[model samples]
Target: MAIHFFEEDIRSEIQQKRNLKNWIKKVAAGKSFRIGNINYIFCTDEYLLEINKAYLNHDTLTDIITFDQSERFGEIDADIYISAERIRENADILGKTYQEELRRVLIHGILHLCGHRDKSPAEKKSMREEEDKALNLFDSADVPRGTLKK
Candidate 1:
């Protein structure tokens, strides 16, 4: 019933941790699910690359990787690993601020824990739509947008 952020090979912090938790709660409520313990691990690209390779058997580096450990429909337990370096690069490429891109990735990981997949073009589109919805939730919340960045 909590969201925790940990750093690995990196010392960055999430500026809006509390607001992000509330936003996640709203998102889970919309899906008729409950918020469980969610561990967000922020790390360097090299650190996450090792996780991707060792656990997923993938040799490529990715911005985020989620390991879902939910035991039931209404519960969620996931280990989400995010690469800070990749997020920064992606933010530049997408014309979004680093916080915005990072938020998208964080929401993307939660969406995956909620059983959303992005293996196909159609699925990818749906995932994007969900991410937008989550971001909209953030916008609608009372928190200031600038508070999302450090």
Candidate 2:
């Protein structure tokens, strides 16, 4: 279980990588999943736009784009690209702090890797519930150290 962070077209600071890794590991374990290699690439809106256009064939700017490469049920391997500018803007628009929204987006991708989707109304509700649970896991500061679940 390795979490890698990279910055492109924007060099910024991401806080508490160690703590976040721990939180994500706890979330995955709780979901009966195992953590694999996760690369978090942070970049500007333009950079993410190019990524969206090139890889997804969509000409729009989004906060995050997750490329899941997991081959099995338990393992998770993904490259999650995030647009910092969009996150900040979204934070402002949503009346939340930058850190709050950023964490939500981060764990949102992790949830997707855990097989949570938000395409439909019911799926979106379930995904949001899972996101809230995962967020609460971090907020409570009582994470377990159990091995990854099968």
Candidate 3:
């Protein structure tokens, strides 16, 4: 299971590919069964908006959009598009940093691939709980991973 991160930022920030890859592997170790290929595209909201419209038929702003391309041959091919712009906006709205919101969104997508759905009110609540659990595990420190509330 390889987690590949592609940054489309003209001015690349402090995203460490190795650390992010390790985190992904740790989170997906026994879940999702990511085997062959997994791609994460980090970009601006404009880019993700275009992707949302083109791929999902939704023309609204979102933080992350995941496309499962896994075939019957067990090749887990998938694309997860993350919107940094929306993350920043959401972080401000939730009184957290961009990193916090980004991490939450990142785990949200991973849980999605792990058969976690958040389409309904109850599902959304459960998904939030799972996201918090994942974040706590991912952090494993006393500093508290994020400031966002479920």
Candidate 4:
């Protein structure tokens, strides 16, 4: 069970990896799922856009794209790509700090692996509620500040 963070065409890093990993585990456990190898590939909007176009065939910018590769039930094995550029812009627009938006995106991918969908209005509402619960957990936990260099 591991969570790895990497950057592609970006200069950002998750400094509090240990805390973040533990928090992720807790979140998965809450959903009755176990953590497997999860790779978080952070990149620029352009980089993620290329991926979106090549793989998803969508020529639109998105905050995150999750690829689920679980081989068994209750085990998460996936690669999640995030756009740091979008996170920053979203933070400004939503009046949230950069760290807050980043954490939301991070857990949003995990929630997706846990079978949360946001395609419909009801699903989107439920997804947001789940995200809020996870964020509350993060707020009450002993996690440190997230660092992402622009």
- Per-prediction TM-score, please? 0.92, 0.90, 0.81, 0.92
| Model 4 per-residue lDDT tens digits across residues 65-150 | 99999999999999999999999999999999877898899999999999899999999999999999999988884555564333
Ranking by lDDT: 4, 2, 1, 3
Encode model 2's per-residue lDDT on 18-128: one tens digit a residue.
777888888988889888999999999999999999999999889999999898889989999999898899999999888788889999999999889999999999998
Tell me how far the alpha carbon of residue 20 in candidate 3 is from the true structure, in angstroms, after superposition.
Answer: 2.7
lDDT for residue 121 in candidate 2, whole number 0-100: 100
User: What's the distance in Å from true for residue 117, model 3?
Assistant: 0.7
User: Where does candidate 4 have its weakest 10-residue lDDT segment?
Assistant: 141-150
Worst 10 residues of 1 by lDDT: 141-150
User: After best superposition, candidate 1 residue 30: deviation in angstroms?
Assistant: 0.9
Candidate 3 per-residue lDDT over residues 22-42, each given as its tens digit:
566666664745545788788
Candidate 2 has its poorest 10 consecutive residues by lDDT at 141-150
What do the candidate models score in CA lDDT, each in turn?
A: 0.86, 0.87, 0.74, 0.89
Query: Which stretches of candidate 1 lie above 4 Å from their native place?
Result: 142-150
